[model samples]
Target: MPTVRLPVPSGDVWARTDYETLPDDLPVRVSLVHGNLVLNARRRPVHQRIARRLATCIEDAAPDAWQVDMDVDVLLDDDELEPSEIAPDIVVYSAEHDLYERPIPADLVALVVEVVSPSTKRKDRRIQPTLYAEAQIRHYWRVETDQTAPAFAIYTYELDDATGEYVATGVHHDRLTTTVPFDLDVELKTVREP
Candidate 1:
């Protein structure tokens, strides 16, 4: 097998349209951040496990008007020159959206979750939260996996309209309970089950 190099558009910065033209079969996950192309290797098994199980839990508790999906792009800024698009581990969005749409608009998103991994620690904890907050997404949850007794910890945040930033609302170690994205409760350990 040979390495496939991404075809870069001739421009000062990569735009949303440029990103859309990239081959879907590319081996890595690519995102447009600050007008640059950022590549991330495939997620680890534990990362995928946490995302999948947690998404199921959220979907079960979500209201009839909202839906849950994993590893789908959310378009934060649709600027022609320097658009920003990112895929979260899990996204809770309006059911009214078209089913065939790619890069779901940020405004349509109710909540976004990221299961932190070694590869995504800085982006998940710092960069992504800022982007989601700036886009005014209502809720953000970061799941930090641990090798210790707790297994995982979920840090929840809500958008602060006054400052346009996320304010940490709660941190749950064993169980997660929240009412903002609709009343929901789940045992964090379920994400680690075999």
Candidate 2:
């Protein structure tokens, strides 16, 4: 006997509800970007592994700091408490604030990292980075899997408070070493490997 398949909804069919109403067990990763629901499937093995390794490196470097996943929302409000948000792959938030909270402001974030997946490459490279910068996020890093060069392209962004925006300070093609908040060094090649 032949089996029938049901039709699935197309083009962002997820329910539009308050982010707080989202169930804890929801299978997909969800975030609100300008009132638009952005739902994504679970990360591929490569992406997950990279995120984990990068998290470890940052933690090792900044022991007192907090590193969180894209599940946590970062709010960017100009006047009212607008929850225009984005969940980055990895975020290092300030140690001064309440780490366990929802919708942490972009100003409180120290670093935001996005691992480029083939499916979301355009969004990751173009849209997300630009939005993060506009939100005045201090540091933004773009990690790309370099099969040809065997290293990741780590780009660091610095925020100019006077302009209320972020600027690309440096693009490190080699292993990255930093002393911005604290002394730390990490080899991009090591993190890029399988």
Candidate 3:
């Protein structure tokens, strides 16, 4: 991936307005985290492979009413100055919504998956899950990849409506089978294959 310049915001914090108004042709990739504009680095090939594979599997199994999208921002808040907008590795949302919409609202999102990377381990494991739960997204999956091989550990969580938090539903190693949002069964190791 080639480098591209990130836009500079006038205020100390990068507001939602700044991110929303970026040039259409800008080559950079970024995500707004708690009011900060986080410039994303190019992902490792293994990371990309896993994300693409999981997305494909999810889309194949998705029902007619649902759609799968990758690296798209899901709006968790609308505050102009301190909004929280996160772009998960993969998102499963309602098909009724327009795909071109700038940010997919949290309400329409049924599931968000994060393929953990060294740089994003903390955020993916802790911060992101918290934000998704707070937004009431029904399901979440954290994929832990072993750089040495195709081995993976997939952890699935379902929102506990009463506590406004996620409760562990399953911890998968060889296969990921889930029955929320829709039924899905993915052979976890296939994610690393060419």
Candidate 4:
């Protein structure tokens, strides 16, 4: 993964009035979470394949009100642009929200998915899920990649309101079939194939 840091400060780029600005054509995925500016590294080939395929499948099955997008920012706070932006790999958001001027709020998001890679495995498995849960995003999915084969690990989670956390609904090694947000059917092998 690639990361570029601004010269302003350790934990923020949006706080200082005199902070240097990002380039007009920033290329990499960037986020501000918990006062830290995070730039996701360039994605591996396999990671891209899985993320796109999964997004396609889900979009096909999702309801008309839901739209699927990749590498889009979700603002943790509806009011501010700093210290809480998270760019999930795939976000299923309701079309009802007028998000043209703002990042999609958690309530408008039906599901957020992250395809795990070597560099992001820990954060994908731990940090992101917790954040999504607390945001009450309702559904979270983590896809674990398998480099040697076309089969991947896919886990589905539902928010447990009592605990403010995600509870595993199922872990699928070959296929994921669910109807939480909408009817979904995804094959791990086909999604991972070259």
Best by TM-score: 1
**TM-score of each prediction:** 0.95, 0.78, 0.89, 0.84
Clash pairs, candidate 3, are none
Residue 18 CA error for candidate 1 (Å)? 0.9
Model 3 ranges with Cα > 4 A deviation: 1-6, 10-12, 24-28, 148-151
Best by lDDT: 1
C-alpha lDDT (0 to 100) for residue 79 of candidate 4: 31
lDDT of 1 at 12: 90
Q: Candidates' lDDT values, in order? A: 0.89, 0.70, 0.86, 0.78
Q: Which tens-of-lDDT digit does each residue in 1-194 have in candidate 4?
A: 46645556634345322222545356666666665667778798878888999899988888889999988777664433344668899999988977563567787898999998888977899998887887899999998778533657888999998998999999899788898988888777788788
The clash numbers for all candidates, in the given order, read 0, 0, 0, 2
Candidate 2, residues 1-194, lDDT tens digits: the string is 35423223233432223555666666667666655567776788888888888877887787576554544677754322234667788888877667677677888887888888777778877888777877777777878776313556877767787875667767776578887645779887778778
Q: How many steric overlaps does candidate 4 have?
A: 2
* Runs with alpha carbons beyond 4 Å of true place in candidate 1: 147-151
For model 2, name the residue pairs that clash. none
> What is the alpha-carbon lDDT for the whole of candidate 3?
0.86
Q: By TM-score, rank the candidates, best first.
A: 1, 3, 4, 2
